[model samples]
Target chain A: MKLLTLNFLTCAIKTCKTNPASFPLHPRDAELEIQEADLNLTFLKNILPRLMWEELRVISSELGLPELPATPPAPADLVEPSNTPLDTAEVTLAEGGAEAQEVEETPSQTAKDLHRILLETCIQEGKLVCGSCGHEYAVKEGVANFLLPGHLV
Target chain B: MLPTPSTSHVCFDRVYEPAEDSYLLLDTLSSPSETSFLQDRFKHANSSPPLVLEVGVGSGVVLAFVAANTQSIFGRQDTLTLGTDINSFACRAASQTVRDAIKERENGRSVFLDVVNGDLGSAIRPHSIDVFIFNPPYVPAELPDLSRHEYYNTIAEGKKATSFQQDSYLLQLSYAGGEDGMVVTNRMLEQVPEILSDERGVAYVLLCAQNKPEVVKARIRDWGSGWNAETVGSSGNKAGWEKLVIVRIWKSAD
Candidate 1:
């Protein structure tokens, strides 16, 4: 399972459905695998608006990734293509010796980090414990077992 | 576009391969009318990126098609596309199929496709799914064949059993649709009210003649007071005259 999927999942127990602590299941002893995938700026920008920014930040921090901004950028800023010449600016900055244009490139660079954190990282094996119920759902061979017992079902 | 079974990983021999039923479901969803209907529904709802789920996403082709198409039009990168199957092999095959499908697409839209190994939509949340798609096991079989208990017992004993025993058990789980072929489909129909979004949520389910589409429609209507079911499309194969029916279910305001 990928960390992205974990964001939407909560404790599946019926009684925990409305429980405030049921969600954002805490991952314990998670084994991570980073596989390189093509970075599509369009895709990353599109998904940014729908992400639960705070929950994502918590997960990213839990996984030891760099901190995401406390608040996501305005939705409008993300979907609309930036006219800042991101590519050209990066090239010019590299030639001018990195430090000079560092501030100008942060937005695009941050987008890349978010993309890597959400899509490229996969949880190969681990257990997700419900914050409310303390029920542990095990992830084996990359598939999380969320099935409850017959009584729970 | 649905990927051919050949495009799936080699281990998918035990997985339910994409067949005529799968293609019919894809064609129904791909129809221009259906596409526009879904687009209009989402546009009107102004809901957050809609959640589209496929129950029993054998090879993941159907869900991939919907995801790719919706992403192209809805232009929402956060649109969640999920698939669930009881079989672990099918789950893995589904992941591979979705990856291959996205890689083959011309557009660079990235869809969040997640596959969980579970029965029907048991793992999913209630009243959260915006679009539901299911292609269930609808082939008629005897009582013994429909017994999940027996199936698991065989699997437990599979270590000492022959390869044939294991293969048969997998086949039974994939194809055996006890009684009128409505066993599994009925179980899923009962879950529609629980999983479907309260407003304007729609489900496309593939049914066959043996499953008695009329009975299934009545059952769905009874499942929800204002819910309605309509036959979206149907096709018949010449060889065995095996007919496939696609039914759309949704709640009516009035």
Candidate 2:
């Protein structure tokens, strides 16, 4: 038991050095995450001229986002309206209530699903860059620590 | 001599004879349509004797136009125009062009133009320039094996090329983006605050291919709330393959 524990500790330390959490996972997977982190409405609008939408949709789906629609959503539908509107009282109490919580949980669940795909499929075996500044993180033993210097803080 | 075919949406008028390098570079001002394309903007702005600085002045085509236009406007040629480029060859060519243009003019020509060999904003006095124009090189780098004539021309000459050769301006102006494509442009955007003197006129940059406008906007957003950048205009590149965008930036005066 003593020998096994010593071996485990050595391996953990090696893991720490190799996985600086600043390196990217797989190049392709890391690329997808980088795009996801970089992509947004402001970026999308400005990038529309340079972006090939078909290519973006394909990449997004590969990273597990549903393929965006073929055509742009009309201006009126720019932000899709929420389908479910709960009563104010229920909405307030629901924050404290677990009753009929399933409906309320869908969006959060969807977000989690997307997050899991990003963390697992894209970032898990992939790379995690500094989301704040697009710095790539090295990975070791599936852990990514992106702690930066105080000046960079 | 004939009109060169332009890609969809691109509106260039004069296509120069193919350079020794075979790439068809349009002199955007060589023909009426193309000249009009650029001229219309300045005319529309309707500003008088504007303080203009041309970065990457190349063969001085744009500088010549501004000089001639200013002579026509001021009626005595009393306009302040400056052109700068990193390429010594280009600088020499521009200085000669200015001298020749001035010589050809009838007596009492009043336009004042200076050509400097250096990076943008370095040769000029601070807070003295009003309009800054740049058409930067936006080509991506090639693979190690590719060896074309244009590639050779684009490569900056090294010490071996001559007894004392400096870096080529083209090499300085061109970038392969960041490791992804935003790196060089990001650095350029940071210089905007230092370059702008007043908030009235905007600093204009013409970016090409996938990098220009897109990378520029992303860099500004990353810069946060202190500055303001806007995509004031865009046009089709002479080669219909990519769009050219004109971005205007301004720094607030506290």
Candidate 3:
């Protein structure tokens, strides 16, 4: 087991050096697609509850996603890190609007529209996320990877 | 053109004296479709003297008509035409039809088909081709019955009816695309990016719409990224209420 771990570690290090995420879609390309969708702040307020915050943070940091809060309150002194983890809390100050009412009346419809816009932007513009899970599904070669290992199930 | 009576004990001029079934199949293909694929070809490149290939050449009806038109307009400019079908009988009939067309001189002389028989992509030289055309066998959601007359039978035979329920149904290598109607179309689209020419041409594919145009279009849109495609022409056949559509796709510089 230790030898296997060592082997995997060596391969990972080599892979990182060779093909780093320094390229576009390194991280935020998948998670921040919702931001590009001409959406209102209400969308973020409503959708924050649906995602895995930690995973979102990791994807955002890797892709250098700015305009995302580092924490729930979004402290003024909280200097943006070289990268931020996706673990920040879901709740943020509400931005009241007609979109919020639309969400209240037809939550499922809103979810679907949000999901579709997210998918289209990601696919057409290199944004990647799962169609069902809202998890970050990396896009490569115009293929959106929605792979879920057995353990995740 | 009128069908001449049997003479000289030799069918030297008729490649296919269409049997009832073959006539119906040819009619299904040649009938006008709503999506005119030829218009797309003409829209992208109107060069009249372009080289064209028609695979699975059935009765040689379309080839005969197209060749005749080209000859009348071009007057004698260079043009290359080839037709290939898996069936030897079909190839023989096509060759005979070309001979007849040449003899009549109504179409033109020196007009010949580079016809052959083999699997798709085989039997053709690489990149030496310009336009690739197909009217692939597309009867929707059919069962594997033991009818020798079926076009699927022309593709492969000997599978038991019980085998149709297996996972290999789609991979039957004949027809049947699982439960959904898009399986065979998907496999065909997957091969298009490779077998089709990328530099100066596109493939014109004809399919019968059996109430699955949306599925077909979605698959086309997905597989066709670097390529541009549109319906050129369409015609309808009364049987099965089938609508045959022609789709011509070209590679864009973008």
Candidate 4:
């Protein structure tokens, strides 16, 4: 499973739905893998508004990944520096253009790093523990088992 | 007509084979009306791509179809797809189907999240899903005993794969809805309103004639003042039975 999946997943227990703490299932002993994929520049530029950055930061630190910025990057931070050689291609549109208006703008290192963490990283094996109940959902061969036991359900 | 995702590598003995109900979901989702509806719904300037979740992905033909045609259907290349299945075999097999189908597309790549092994949409966070879909067990047959799910979900001791009997049990989970075939569908319907995003969340559910599509739509309309359920696609009118139809449920912006 892509690490990004944790952003939208919560504890499966019915009772946990009402609890905000039930979200962002915490990973334990997670075996990580990186699978290369095509990066959508548009997605990279527009990802922050959809992301729970605080939760994502917690997840990254838990997984022992490089710590992220304390705050989410603005869309303007996702573009190449105007001084770079790539800027030659986008030089005409650099003047007074709002964020991401020019199709010619190249993605910055920050965008690539964000793309890698969210899209390329995978959790092959782990246990996702619910914060509210501490119930463990096993991740086996990249597929998490969210099936609760009869009594729990 | 869009190319159907191939399930050739899937073992039908354990997984649910693509059938009429599955095809109806594919056709309805990719139809001109649906495409236009979805595009218009998420067409805001630089809006984040919508998340598409399909419960009980079965052979993954439907999810894979949506992933491969995100540009055509969702009008966004970055639409994300996630799936869940109670049958472990289906979860594994369907993941491959989705990945392979996406790889086959030369361009316009979409993201595919992993397929979790879970019951229905229980694992999803509240108000997290933008577009949800289901082609549930609507056969009006007795549901298989789920106590054996863990055993059937995994290979027997010392075996290379699941036994023939276990395979059959897994396949049974794909259909067999128990008592008018609405047992599973009913449970899922109850979750629809809770799981969907309040802003633009929409859902597509496939129902057979026996599932009482009319009553289901009426009940959905009663979900609240803004809720609406409409049949957007159907096929096979033999014996006056709508063999299969797709009901699109959404909260209208009133």
> Which candidate comes out best when scored by lDDT?
4
Candidate 3 lDDT, tens digit per residue, B1-254? 22321213323222233333333333433334411433343323224334456765655655554454443322332334566554434555564565455455533333343344333433233333456666654555653432222243123458543232332332232334334445445544655565454555567676566636555655566664666667665564456566666666667766
Candidate 4: how large is its RMSD? 3.3
Better of 2 and 4 by lDDT: 4
lDDT of candidate model 3 versus the reference:
0.40
Each candidate structure's count of clashing pairs: 0, 14, 21, 0
Q: lDDT by residue for model 4 over A16-93, one digit each (tens)?
A: 989988988999999999999887777777667989999999999999999999999888888777746456546546
Q: Can you list the residue pairs that collide in candidate 1?
A: none
Per-residue CA lDDT of candidate 2, range B1-254, in tens? Answer: 32222222211111111121111122332335433433443343224334567766566555555555443432323434566654444554554555455445554332334454444443233344555666654545431211121233222467333122123323433333443344544545555555555534446665655665666666665655545666555454456655656566655545
Best by DockQ: 4
Residue range with the least summed lDDT across 10 consecutive positions in model 4 chain B: B235-244
Q: For each model, chain A TM-score?
A: 0.74, 0.26, 0.29, 0.86
Compared with the true structure, what per-residue lDDT tens digits does model 1 show for residues A15-120? 8868877767778889988866666554555556557788878877887878888888653344335545676577677788555653332336566566677777
The stretch of ten residues in a row with the least summed lDDT in candidate 1 chain A is: A98-107
lDDT of 4 by residue, B1-254 (tens): 99999999999999999988898898999999999999999866499879999999999999999999999898788888999999998999999999999999999888888899999999998998999999998888889987668888998788898898998888888999999899999999999998999999999999989999999999999988999999999976667654888999999999
Candidate 4 residue pairs in backbone clash: none
